[model samples]
Target: MQLFYTPDITDSPIYYLSEEESKHCIRVLRLELADHVQLIDGRGGLYEAEIVDAHPKKVALKLLTRELEYAKRNHYLHIAVAPTKNIERLEWFLEKATEIGIDEITLINCQRSERKEAKAERLNKIITAAIKQSLKAYHPKLNDITPLQKLIAQPFDGQKFIAHCEPGDKQDLSKTLKPNSRYLILIGPEGDFTPKEIEDALQNGFEPITLGNSRLRTETAALEACFEINFLNR
Candidate 1:
């Protein structure tokens, strides 16, 4: 089934695709009038619709069916990781994490972070594309670049962990994780989190956990954490 993203889709029977989506539907995909297509609101709403007008600029659709909480996961994952030196690597993490099932993401700036900033608009686009490609109903929340200490101070109801290579007693992330729960994990930058930052996180209620013995890059470690959480729930 061809899936299209319509984040603004409402309960109205008649819905019009955005100009960009319309062009893709009518011109690129060559889906003509009466073609059946699927639309996702990125809020757990899946819609089945028939094309009413095949105009490339504003293809119209008649909504036939709607399903809420379609394929919704039983768990919630929120990762706050330091942005990689290469923006592309961070973008790669975002795309893969979305496909792997993540509930939220925050590009954090650590003391040793090489890349302190990110293009939210571009990253969000990548996530949206991944959601459509993966045929997911929910969209992960992408937060603006935040400071490490700031995120560490926030209150989280479920598990809270900090994955770093610092010398200290830590638990294995895979074994430490619990299923069907909300989680917030912190992943350090290329240089890893500083001792003080690690201390700060621990002091702020974030438990120290190790992804594994083999050291991984910033983006790889983040994706590994995402996969671990989703796998545990599965």
Candidate 2:
């Protein structure tokens, strides 16, 4: 099933594909008039559409059917990690996390963070592609880059955890997670979170957790936490 991302599909029965998406459908995929295509609004709506005009630059489609989908997981999973110095690694984490199932993501700047910024546009594109590849109807939200202190200060309704390499009273992430409950996990940069940063998180009601014994890279730890949470919920 070829799924296209069309987040702005309103109540109108007809819709025009974007130029990039049009080229892919008409030119690359060679979808002809009357051919059926699938669309996802990234807002829990899946639509079955038929190609009305096979214009390479502006392919049009008529909606045939619509279905609303709920998230596979009962709860929300939010992972905030310090951006990796090598952006490709961060991109890889985003792709896998989206495929596995994630509700939200935030890039946090820690004291030891090497890269303080993330390309929102490019990262969002990666997320879109991942959703299409994984056939997910809902799009995970990508939050702007935030500082460690500011992020910890925000109010969260569910369990909050900080996964770090610090040797303290830390619980196993998989065991600590509660099924069907909202979760927010923090993964630090390559150099890891500073002592003061960990203390601050602890004071702000964030529990310290460990992924495992072996020290992992920033992206690896982030992805591991993402998987662990989803796995436990399953």
Candidate 3:
């Protein structure tokens, strides 16, 4: 089944595809009138639609059915990680995390961060593609770049963890994770979080957790945490 990302879909009986989506459907895919297709609003809404007009610029569709909260997961995961120096690595992480069922992501700036900024537009595009490719109805939110301290100060009801290489008492992330619960995990940069940063996180009720025995890169460690959380929940 070919699933299209339509974030603006509503409860109306008739809906129109965007210019980009229209072009792909009518021109690229060669879909014609009466052709059936599936659409996801990226907010847990799935629609089965039939093409009424195969216009190349604005394909009109008649919604046959709509399902809300389709295939919703039992757990919510939010990963706030320091973006890698290489933009490509961070992009790869976002793509895989979206495919693996992450609920939210934040690019955090740390004291030891090599790259302090990121292209939010490009990264968001990658996430949207991954959601459609994975046939996911829920879209993962990509938060703007945030300061490490600022995020730590925010309110979170779920378990909070900071994964750092600092040599102190830390719990294994896989073992510490509580299944079917909301989670927020922090991943440091390649150079790792500073001693003061680690201390600040601990003081703020964030537990120190280690991914594994072998040290991993910033992106790798973040992905590992993502996969571990999903695996445990599975």
Candidate 4:
């Protein structure tokens, strides 16, 4: 079953289907009257509906059921990383990360970060596709590109980590993760985090984490951290 994300769920027995979705439904899928479909709002509301009528520009559905999803686990995974200089790599991370299940992502600007300005609109589209492709109802929240210094100050009530390749006492990301615990992992630029930046993170209560012994690209490190968090939860 194909499910589309719709943030707004109405109870008046009406929904304004987007033109593109309407066209896909009526022309591409050719769904007939009373055909069933699912609509999800990234905020955990899933609506089960049956088609009332199929119009080229307006396909209507009658809400059959609405399910409010509970949190699968107690913890949340938030990955903040510098966007790769190559836009494709950044986009690749976004797609796979969403597929693998991430709670939130922040594009951070670090001293060595090659790419400073990241577009949120394009990333939003990629995330939406990943959510549909992976058959997930929840869409991870995406933050505007922010300075690494500014992002560090954000409230993180649970475990916080900074993934770096520098030699020092650093914990393995997977080993340090706690099941059902909220986590925030910060990844640095291609050149890695500056000494002062690392010091600042530690001072702010972010523990040092190592993805593995091998050196990975900015996007790779971020994706690896994401997978580790999900794996620990599983």
lDDT of 1 by residue, 1-234 (tens): 578999988888999999999998988898988999999999999999999998999999999999999999999999998888888899899999999999999989899999878889999999999999998999999999998888888888999999999887999876777779999999999899999999998899888998888999999999999998888888
Off by over 4 Å in 4: none
Error of 3 at 231 (Å): 0.9
Each prediction's RMSD to truth: 0.9, 1.1, 1.0, 1.5
Superposition TM-score, candidate 1 onto the true structure: 0.98
Each model's TM-score, in the order given? 0.98, 0.97, 0.97, 0.95
User: In model 2, where do residues sit more than 4 Å from their true spots?
Assistant: none
> lDDT per prediction?
0.92, 0.92, 0.92, 0.85
In model 2, what are the clashing residue pairs, if there are any? none
lDDT of 2 at 217: 97
Count clashing pairs, candidate 2: 0
Q: Count backbone clashes in candidate 1.
A: 0
Model 4 CA lDDT for position 171: 86
lDDT string, candidate 3, 1-234, tens digits: 567899888788899999999999988999999989999999999999999999999999999999999989989999999999999999999999999989999999999989988888899999999988888899999998899999998989999999999788899867777889999999999999999998988889999998889999999999999999988999
